[model samples]
Target: MTNPVKGPTGRVPGWVKVVGSVVLLLAVLFAGLRLSVLPGLKDLFGTETRDRSGPALLESIQDISRYEAASGNFQVVVDLEKDAKFLPDAVRGSRTLYVGAGTVDAYVDLGALDGDDVRVDDDRTSATLRLPHARLGTPALDPERSYAVSKQRGLLDRLGDLFSDNPHSEQAVQKLAVRHIGDAAKESGLTGRAESNTTEMLENLLRSLGFKEVRVTYGD
Candidate 1:
């Protein structure tokens, strides 16, 4: 009463059955292996994420689309991030703006935050700016005089960056450092806000010194 499904012989043919079972088992093992390994392939369908801190290749920048301007002031739109974009098809391509483009010696008077980041009345070429003031509080830095905020670390970072063939590597490092330390840092003595303003001032000063089409915002 051996099953006829076993093959032409009354008893299952050893070779045929073994071959059939082995094929079936191999198929199953392959399927199981594929199932076990499949989820990892899900991420592969997508490409790796990219960061464009500075200008991109193949693409060009023109007409830096005027992202933000403080209404009628000095027409200021500062992009704190390096990837600020522009019209892609212009004759002149994308150029990046960076820090160290100005003197870190920008002097903040211990006056008041008159909300005067920049002020322009009308038909005036030379505008006035009342940048944020600092008291340095009880351990006060003198109001009439100037004080250095001491971004010397930033300077050293830039120096290292200069020697490196790729400046973006430093920026990448900065981005990482910002991610790790940024939270506690904001609440710490040096608010990232202050650092940001400093950067903005540096850019604006350079803009006045004649860097065209500047912007200041968080990286979009």
Candidate 2:
């Protein structure tokens, strides 16, 4: 061999340079995997979600005959707890916090109208209408916007969930939410607003039909 080829002082050895290059390449690969630059590798470790639900079935359809005059949007937080009679919270109790959103419609039932509900003068220049009071419809919850905020369960409750088909039942909370929304709608003057709107609508309609005067009244 020719003289052994000594390099300059402080220069790295060929083997050390080779090792550093290998380490740098490995670091780049790891970074690429973390950043999802390689689709094949990313799919290997990624989670796939699937919707296994069936198609929606057609239910009975009924014709609506009520005028939707006003709607109230409501939100409520429900805190519900259940406990065993003789067990401590840690042993057999559960608590949940849910946020519910819904809407309540106030409507006037034009379907309930009768001959006596409307009156016209001989010349048809004046008219009178007696209509039923506005009523509130059922509270409709917005499932897309409502969700459980937090839940805490005891050891036994947690264990029972492992074998239960419906681990976390929300029926009670949902019912409570509907009830609360209904109550709020009752106190929100929504029916009054509906009545006012219906009166205005009838007045405008009758006026356009050649009636110069219109009197609207709400009763049974």
* Predicted structure with the largest lDDT when compared to the true one: 2
TM-score for each of the candidates? 0.17, 0.77
For model 1, state the Cα shift of residue 41 in Å.
Answer: 33
Best by TM-score: 2
Question: What are the per-residue Cα lDDT tens digits for candidate 1 across 35-127?
Answer: 668997645554687896987577665542111211110111112332224523232222232221111111334233344455544544444
User: What lDDT would candidate 1 get against the real structure?
Assistant: 0.40
| Per-residue lDDT of model 2, residues 166-213, tens digit only | 987888889999999999999999999999999999999999999999
- In model 1, residue pairs whose N, Cα or C atoms come closer than 3 Å (at least 3 residues apart or on different chains), thus clashing, are 61-94, 77-215, 77-216, 78-215, 78-216, 78-217, 79-215, 79-216, 79-217, 80-217
Candidate 2 pairs with clashing backbones: none
Computed on alpha carbons, the lDDT of every model, listed in order, comes to 0.40, 0.92
Q: Cα lDDT for residue 184, model 1? A: 31
Locate the minimum summed-lDDT window of 10 residues in model 1.
69-78
Q: In model 1, where do residues sit more than 4 Å from their true spots?
A: 1-118, 122-125, 128-183, 192-220
Query: Residue 151, candidate 2: how far off, in angstroms?
Result: 0.3
